[model samples]
Target: MRIAITGSTGLIGTALVRSLTADGHHVVRLVRRPPRTPDEVEWDPRRQWVDTDGLAGCEGVVHLAGAGVGDHRWTAAYKKTIRDSRVLGTAALAEALASLDTPPRVLVSGSAIGIYGDTGDRETDESTPPGHGFLADVCQEWEEAAGPAAEAGVRTVFARTGLVVARGGGAWAKLFPLFRLGLGGRLGSGSQYWSFIALHDHVAALRHLLDTGTLSGPVNLTAPRPVTNREVTAVMGRVLHRPTLCTAPAPALRLALGEMAGDVLASQRVLPRRLLDSGFSFAFPDVESAVRAALTDTR
Candidate 1:
């Protein structure tokens, strides 16, 4: 299959490109800048400009282009950037794909479990109602922007991802060094549920979705068992052979992250019910095992 991808330099996109290429699929990267190679297609989501002719033969599209929610302080401008990046990028991709002579069979657009907001301890699946907040609003708009592709009879899948656990460059990566030095601790009251998934499983589940025609809409790319923030700290300490004795209070988080503190402390007890029901098995289904594998150099 020929696959066109946006955000190919991102954590998930990088892994997806490697895996998809290894599986013998042709991959084209959609770039915001001028195309430097035959494999790159120029696109400007903000301007709604895409090289539709270059994407003529794409069999599938994985739209992962978006501003990183945790990458910057949540200033008013940064918040708008977050929303615009997803909404505009997705809208552009969907519109472009809709214009293709042979439109892609599937559009696995990126989303987040943040759409569910603070779900407390409730196990949320695809059918669950979206909760309130900026993140939720952003996700809602992001998914809605893909309406063009879906309305054109294209099979669209919104990968409502969770906190992806990986060795480098993700949330867990930043936490690993601190935890390994025995400086890790629980956040806030340490009771908020943290829904997460291993990077390997995340990529694999995406591949599964690409192959499965029945799966579409919002699919939670999370583990079956969700853990509390305290549990996460304890498990990381156990894995790293360290002790979690300190506490990072809500005030400190608010001071450091500003309005993004809500994101850091939000409780989203999501479940991969759709994926599981579709018979997609996970490589790391629990926090303990997932952390060990992700943090360790060897499997």
Candidate 2:
């Protein structure tokens, strides 16, 4: 299948491209810069412009381009950047797909589990209503921005991904160094649940969403077993042969990380209800397995 993907160089996007190409599918990367190769197409999301014609032969689309939520301090300005990056880019891509002479059969747009803010001890899924917080609001708008594709009769699936347990990028990237150096500790009260999935399963889930014709709306991408921050500290320490004796109190985290600390402290015991219901199995479902998969080549 011929597919077009945005954020093609990102942590998840990069892995998705590798997986798809390995499966013998043609992949086209949508870029902000001018097209440098036949597999690249140019588009400026800030300008809200996409070359619909250039995307003519794509049978599917995955809109994964967005600003890194944790890349900067969560100043009011950077928060706006995060929201605009997702909302604007998704809206533009959906519009372009709607205008295509032969629109893609499916659109697997990016979303985040943050939509269910502070799940606390409660385990939520895609069917659960949105929760309170700035990130939740952004996620709501991010998924809704793809209304054009659904309205155009194309299958649209929102991938509400959890924290990916990959060593190369995302939170795990920073965690690996800290844990390896024996400087790692639990965040906040060490009780908040951290829903996570291995990068291998994450990439596979996106491809599954693209092919699952009957699946639409929100589908969470997370492991079956969610672990708390304290448990995570223990797992990291065990996996790296280190001691887990340190802790980052909530107040100190707030002081050091500012608004970003709230996210770190937030609890999300999310389950992949929809993904499981759709017959998808995780490659790394347990915390130990996920950690090992990220650190070593268990594949």
Candidate 3:
């Protein structure tokens, strides 16, 4: 498949591009600057501009461009940046695709498990209604931004991704070094459920979605099982052969992280109901295997 991707430099995007290209698929990267290579296409979400001609014959589009939630403390301005990056970027991409002479058959627009808020111990799926908070609102707008593509009869799938456990980046990147040095510990109460997926499985599931015709709407990109923060810490320690005894109190997290602490400590036991039902299997369905993969991927 010839796929055009935004945020192609990001954690998941980079892996997906590599995996897809390895499988003999053409991967086109959408960039903010002028196209530096034949494989790149320029786009400006802030200006609501996309070079449509460069995206002429894209078989699919995976919109993953967004400001990193953990990239900075949740200042009001950074929060707005996070919101606009997803909302405006998606809207721009969708509108641009809708105007294309040959729009892609599938648009795997990125969403997040954050949409469900703190799911607590209860397992939430795509059917769950939008949760309350800034991220939830952003997710609602983010998914809705693809209206043009859906209206144009394109297969628009909202891939609500979970905490991607990978070596290069994401939450695990920060955790790996800390865990290796015996400094890693749980966030807040440590009982908060964390739905995580291996980078390989994440890339494969995305490729599966690109071809799966019957799937649409909100499909979670997560492992079959979700583990608690404590469980993850234990697995990290085990994988890295280090001690996991330290603890970060909720008060300290709040003081240090501000509003971001809420998300860090939030308990979300998300499930990939649609992905599982659609027969997408995970290479690392458990936390231990995922941690191992993270280590192996790093090595």
lDDT of 1 by residue, 1-299 (tens): 99999999988899889999998999999999999999999999999889998898888899999998889999999999999999998999999999887789999999999998999888888899999999999999999999999988789999999999987666778898889899999999999999999988999998998899999898999999999999999899988999899899999999999999988998889999999999999989999989877866332
TM-score of each prediction: 0.98, 0.98, 0.98
For residues 1-299, what per-residue lDDT tens digits would candidate 2 score against the true structure?
99999999998999999999999999999999989999999999898999887899899999899999888889999999999999999999999999988889999999999999998989899879999899999999999999998999889999999999987778888899989988999987899999999999999999999998989999999999999999999999999998877788999989988988999999999999989999999889999999998988533
How would you encode candidate 3's per-residue C-alpha lDDT over 1-299 as one tens digit per residue?
A: 78999999999998889889988999999999988899999999999999999899899999999999999999999999999999999999999999987889999999999999887899899899999888889999999999999998889999999999987988777888888789999888899999999988998999999999999999999898999999998888877889998999999999999999999999999999999999888889998998888777842
Question: Model 3 scores what on Cα lDDT?
Answer: 0.92
Is candidate 1 or 2 superior in lDDT? 2
- Predictions in order: lDDT: 0.92, 0.92, 0.92
Q: What is the lDDT for 37 in model 2?
A: 96
Candidate 1, superposed: residue stretches over 4 Å from native: 297-299
Q: How many clashing residue pairs appear in each of the predictions shown? A: 0, 0, 0
lDDT (0-100) at residue 287 of candidate 1?
95
Off by over 4 Å in 3: none
